[model samples]
Target: MKTKISHADVLDITAPSGGTTSGLAVLIGSLFGIAVTTNVAGDTVAVHTSGVFDHVKEGAGSGQAWAVGDAVYWDNTAKRLTKTTTSNTKVGYATAAALTTDTVGRFRIVPFA
Candidate 1:
């Protein structure tokens, strides 16, 4: 089948302040998406904003242990995933547990409605 519009969840958007790198988590207002490529300030980069993505890189909360299926939120200020509810936006659920010592945690991307 031929169509004028293509289906794509990932999009090319201007990088936010501080720039961004591939595999890093990014937020535009309350929306959460993953960086698909590296980009400096004012540059455009591809970001995957939807679907179930596995092993999405994120920061681990201090001394916080995550269990599989735990609800995860995006800490925009910190640009990481956390179990803490303080000023965070709900992004998705934890696909893998993170230990206290782990600096990064893997998550599944389930875009917020």
Candidate 2:
């Protein structure tokens, strides 16, 4: 018997209230993933659960600097990546160094269900 199913790197998730947009991060409860396709609410959309992704980082004033291996979290309300652990979900870690003024940061998604 094969107990293994899929790789789980990508999953089909129902779009939330505002739906999901391609190339954007969506958080459904504690589980979050990067939308691979855009879909309306209640519709199934492909979401990338794992792997490295370039996402919008919290950039204000001098912005937030992230070094390699720095922990990253998902700010649902802000709909972007942040270093603040409080009231945020642990998404992944920084794969590269980011400047304090950088608008985007590269990070690896640490599949959390």
Question: RMSDs, each prediction?
Answer: 3.1, 1.3
Residue 53 local lDDT, model 1: 53
- Please write out the lDDT profile of model 2 over residues 1-113, one tens digit for every residue: 59987898999878999999999999988788899988999999999999999999987564689999999999898888999999999999999999988889999999665
- Taking the tens digit of each residue's C-alpha lDDT, what string does model 1 give over 37-112? 8899799989888765554334443777778898888877766678888788888887777887666666777776
The lDDT for every candidate, in the order shown, is 0.76, 0.91
- Cα deviation of 17 in candidate 1 (Å)? 1.7
Q: How many backbone clashes does candidate 2 have?
A: 0
TM-score of each: 0.78, 0.94
Best by lDDT: 2
**Stretches of candidate 2 above 4 Å error?**
none
lDDT of 1: 0.76
- Residue 106, model 1: lDDT of 67
Clashing pairs in 1: none
TM-score of 2: 0.94
